[model samples]
Structures are given as structure tokens and as C-alpha cells.
Target: MIRRLFSHIDLMVRLLVLAIVLASVLPATGRGYVIAQGVSNAAIFLLFLLNGLRLPRTEVLRGISHWQFLLPLTLWCFGAMAVAGKGFASLADSTLPSTVALGLLYLGALPSTVQSATAYSSLAGGNVANSVIAAALLNILGVFVTVPIISLLGGGEGISLGADGLLKVMLILVLPFIIGQLFQARAKGWIVEHREIVTWMDRLSIAVAVYVAFSGAVSQGLWGKVSVGDWAVLLALVTGFLLFGFGGSWLCGRMLGLSRPDRIAFLFAGAHKSVAMGAPLAAVLFPPAIAGMVLLPLLAYHLLQLVVSAPLANLLSHDPNVG
Candidate 1:
């Protein structure tokens, strides 16, 4: 059981940690930084392009009909979580660096993860169809919705997305996704056939983004600004945020009277945040230094979710109520 649980700390997590460590020890600078950023941007573009190619339009269409489940899930992820993040940010403002505190809010406004959410939902005997659809729809909407929510909630904190930022998002994230979708008919099968390579591409792109972002933060004294006490506080706050996400999502499902399988889907779907989206979007929306700091809470939460989900999925799989 312990070995199985630890397996959740998979290769991707290790890569992420390695990226951070590399950034801490040997951060890119000057010409190297510029080159790294360009590479990171290109990687992000390819990542979204692949995302577009892989997700089936038919699944999205079918899932739209499950509005009974998706609607509440969407509202919870965007609305309730955004509010909770704002509250958490406010609480952390006095204790942590401003950018780090604001990270909690950014984390809240982001959408659910596609891969892990679906994988865990399946493991827990949830409605896999709904989980897939929910993940795709939320990520699609997140490209548009997350920034606006951050702008709305954190605008006073200098987090607004101006015209340039919007255009960058369109080019880097949305445009490639649209392109991939357009080519899906011709390319998706090939992508699926080469899924192993594509998955590694996804991981590599994310790792580059994280490495570039954290490099900037490290250059700007990221470690020095965040003391040990701040680390404890950050951990505590992240834990609270995780509990609220899973607990609130489950309660919302129960209150809406969803079936047990659906509740499991809701639990994972509503709770998990996407580092895939968050990292790339941050690269587009903020400078490397600010993006790195802004990603702190998200990075922590993403890792913890992986650790927690395996055991939780096992428990849910055995639950008599999960029919």
C-alpha cells in the first residue's frame, strides 16, 4: 500500500523538483535567460498544440449535455475556489511575500487538471466519461476564464492582463490549441499512436517553463526572501487550501444529490489544479521572475495532490457507497 501510494510521486514530479533544483543552483542569466525564455515559449506553444490535437471534439460535445454535473463543478472550481483563494491570499499577505500570497489567489482561479483528475477519477470508480469531459471543458474555459478572474480579484495587486498580454495568450496558448483542433482529424491518430513521445513532450515543456521561471526568481533572491518560518506558513496555508478544495467539492456533489460515481468524479475534477495550464499561462502573463514567485503555491499544491490522490482513490474504490 505504501509503495503504491509513493508511486504517485512519479517521474513528472521528480522532473519538476529537478527543474527547481537546477534553477536554484545554475539559473539562466543575460543572453542565456533570453534564449531560455524563447525556448520555453516555443515549448509551451507545442504543448498546447498537442493538447488540441489529442482532445476529441465529440467528447466535449457529449459532456456538455451532462450540465447537471459539469455546471456545479465549474461554478465550484472558478467561483467558490476563487473566493477561497482571495481569502487565503488576504490571510497570507501579512505573513508571506506579496507575490507568494497572490499565488494562492492565482492557484484558486486556475482550472482542474486533465490527466491526473481523469486518472484518479477512474481509479476511484468515478464516471470516467464525465471526468474526461469535465477536464477538457474546464481547461478550455480556463484559457479564457482564469486570467479574467485573476484580473478581477488581483487587479489592485498589479495582475491585470492588458491588450499585449491577451494577444500573447492568444498566440502562445489559444492559437496553437485551435490549430491542433483543426488538424485533429488528420493528426490525432498519429498523436495517439505516439502517445508516449507526446507525453514526454508535455512533461519536458512544463519542466522548461518551470526551470525558466524559477531561474528568474532565484536570480532575484527567491530563496532569501522566503525564510523558514514563511515556509511553514506556506505549507500550512496550502494544506488548508487542499482540504477545502477536496472537501468542498465532495460536499457540493452530495448537496446536489449526484450519484456516488459522479461524486467521485466531482471530488477529483473540482479539486485538482493544472500545472500544465498554470505554468504556461504564467510564462505568457508575467515575467519569469514574477511568474516564478506566483507559481510557488501552485507547485506545492500540485505535488501534494499527487501524493494524496493515490490513497484517496484506493479508499474510494473500496467504498460501498461508490456504486
Candidate 2:
């Protein structure tokens, strides 16, 4: 009986960890004020630090050359999604805040997540090293360049970018990642032996993030601010964005002349945005009310992709070229 349950045990364990975190929050709403805020902030900071430490310094400064295989199509994929959402925004204008329009646009403007790209690349049999390097660089550069795009398309309610933002990116994100990497290297053998521990943190972060997002909203009584009708519209937008990512990334993969495996990596890595990154950026870029609104799409997008993309990823990896 235990053996039967142990099939895909890693995935099961991950889900279990998330469930535990969710359970923890249900008790006191996870709103220990300073404790919650500090832990949440440290988790993201430490997560990035691990990223920095894991990646080569040279690569961080001067990324992999796969843009020949990725950039144009990736940009166009995100661009078209932004246009599609805005095009249809008129239908839901009455339900969500006008800022929802800006939130949708701004989240699309941010770069894809680094770690998820690499994780999916490995799962799909892509060049893991290349995907890892590319993902890290794109995110680092995104901190610098993502702001201008937001400013241009964000109309008026987007984030501000400059030296200050860059500093925050480095201190909060880059430094901690470097620390994690250095610490990992010293204990490289130990880490390898304890791979399960790191894996636990990966899933645990998602669970923590979900609980924090939901609990924070509940604690503030902000859950009441948006009604069922508004939620329906948010769900619709999330669905559209996920599908757009899948379809758009596919076309980009073709345009970039990627072999099937590379295409699979490009599609998942290049297209998935980080709510982890977005939440902080939103808080910095917009007003509190608007930032909360901005996070809605990211929250929706994160959950939708986790469920929808497992099957999609499996299908992509089975392609002959991927094998």
C-alpha cells in the first residue's frame, strides 16, 4: 500500500508541504504582523540569493547567446498577450477596478522566472545549463529594463525605475542569491546528498507564497473588496493569459528554429512570469490599492499554469526531438 502511494512520491511530498503551510495559516490567519512580513521578505531575498550563488558571475553579467533562439518570439508572445487582454478589458470594465487594466499590462511586462525555467527545462530534457543561465540573466536584466516597458505601456500607474530600483534588485535579490550559491558550494556534496531538502524548499516556497497572499488579504478584510463577479472576470483573464502563453511560446519556438527540446524549454521558460517577482515589484511600483490589484492576475496566473501545464509539459517532452 505504501509502495503504491509512493509512485510520483516527490510530487506528492511537494503537495503535502504546501498543504501543511496552508494549514498553518488557517489557524491565526498567519498574520503575526512583524513575523509574517519578515519571514515573507526573507524568503524571497534568500531565494534570490540562492539563485545568485547557483549561477556563475560571468553568466549573470553576460548571459547565454540563445537570444538568437529566443528573444523575438518571446517578446512577441508577451506583447500579443498584453494586447489581447487589453482588447477584451472593455467587457469586464464594470467588475474590476480600472487599475486592473494597468496591473494586467504591468505583470506582462516583467520577465519570466529564472528557477522555474530551469526546473521545467530539466523536466523537459532541454539544455539545463543554457536554460539556467538564460533564465538568470533575463531576470537580472529585467530588473533594469522591465521598468521602461512598464512606464511606456503602464500609461500612468506603473512602477518607477532608476538607480533606486536597481539597488533594490541587487541588495534584495542578487546578494542573497550569491550567498545561497556560496553556501551551497561549500556544502556541494552535502547538498547533493540532501537534494530532497532543496526540493522541499522549492514547493514549500509556493505554498508559503499562496498562504501569505490569501491570508494577508483575509487579515486585511480585503477579500470583501472584490466580489464574486469580479473574481469571475479575474479567472477569465487568468485563463486567457495562460493559453496565450502556451500558444505564443509555441509559435516563438518555431520562429526561433529551436529543435523540439529547446523549443520546449523556450516555451515554458520564456513565457512564465514570476508572481514571486511581481508582488515585490508591484508594491514598489504602484500604490497599495493598485499593487494589490496588480497581484491578482499574477496570483491567478500562477495557480492556473500549475494545473494546466503539467499535461502540456508532458506532451511537449514526448516529441521525438526532445528525446
Among the numbered candidates, top lDDT falls to 1
Provide TM-scores for the models. 0.96, 0.74
User: Which ranges of candidate 2 are over 4 A from the true structure?
Assistant: 1-31, 58-63, 73-92, 99-101, 119-127, 156-170, 178-193, 202-216, 279-292, 319-323
RMSD of 1: 2.1
Which whole-number lDDT from 0 to 100 does residue 210 have in model 2? 43
**Which candidate achieves the best TM-score against the true structure?**
1
In order of listing, the candidates' clash counts read 0, 6
lDDT of each: 0.92, 0.61
For model 2, the local distance difference test gives: 0.61
Q: In model 1, which runs have C-alpha deviations exceeding 4 angstroms?
A: 1-8
